[model samples]
Target: MSQLKEIIYNCKKATSLIERKEIGRLTLRESVELKIHLAFCSVCRIFRRQSITINSMVKMLFNDAQQRQTKLDDTFKKSLQERIEDKLNKNGKKL
Candidate 1:
């Protein structure tokens, strides 16, 4: 039974690799193990469902950000530029 328990735990860890891979964030060993584990685990099947839901949420958040525009108006941008230039001048840095 302990062996079955360890297999279940490893399967959960492996499902995380699906998201990690999407973000360019997995080691080669992790990638291979996740593939191997997924091949045999039913729990990993449920984990994939949860992973897809979370990934969809992330995609929606990014889409919302892309649809929104910065509230910084022209005057604000100008003020920011002036502040940066002032700081650079004070430090004797060429702008």
Candidate 2:
């Protein structure tokens, strides 16, 4: 079908569809079109895999950053509390 051929050749649409596919946002027709395109198009297939890899790497890095930030925040809070307590004790103030 000409529509299928058009879908297969649509690089931009295919790329967006790949992203949608990763997030489960693609409609059934879009999923089918993307699958059919990938089956016959090496370039689009490689792009899809690379996009998946990049998305995974980004997610992993973001999670790692969040964890590190949380740890640092806790450490900072504890250090600040200790400093305040030390200052209060030096000034002969209770608690």
What RMSD, rounded to one decimal, does every model reach? Answer: 4.9, 5.7
Across residues 2-92, which tens digit of lDDT does each residue of candidate 2 receive? Answer: 9988987898989889888898788888888888888889998899889999999999999999888754477888999999988998999
User: What is the alpha-carbon lDDT for the whole of candidate 2?
Assistant: 0.87
For candidate 2, the per-residue lDDT at 30 reads 83
Q: Relative to the true structure, how large is the alpha-carbon lDDT of every model?
A: 0.76, 0.87
lDDT of 1 by residue, 1-95 (tens): 67545644685477668777766787877766776677778777777878788888989999998889658799989999999988988999754
Clash count (model 2, backbone only) = 0
Give candidate 2 regions above 4 Å deviation: 69-95
Between which residue pairs do clashes occur in model 1? none
Candidate 1 off by > 4 Å:
1-9, 65-95
Winning model by TM-score: 2
Best by lDDT: 2
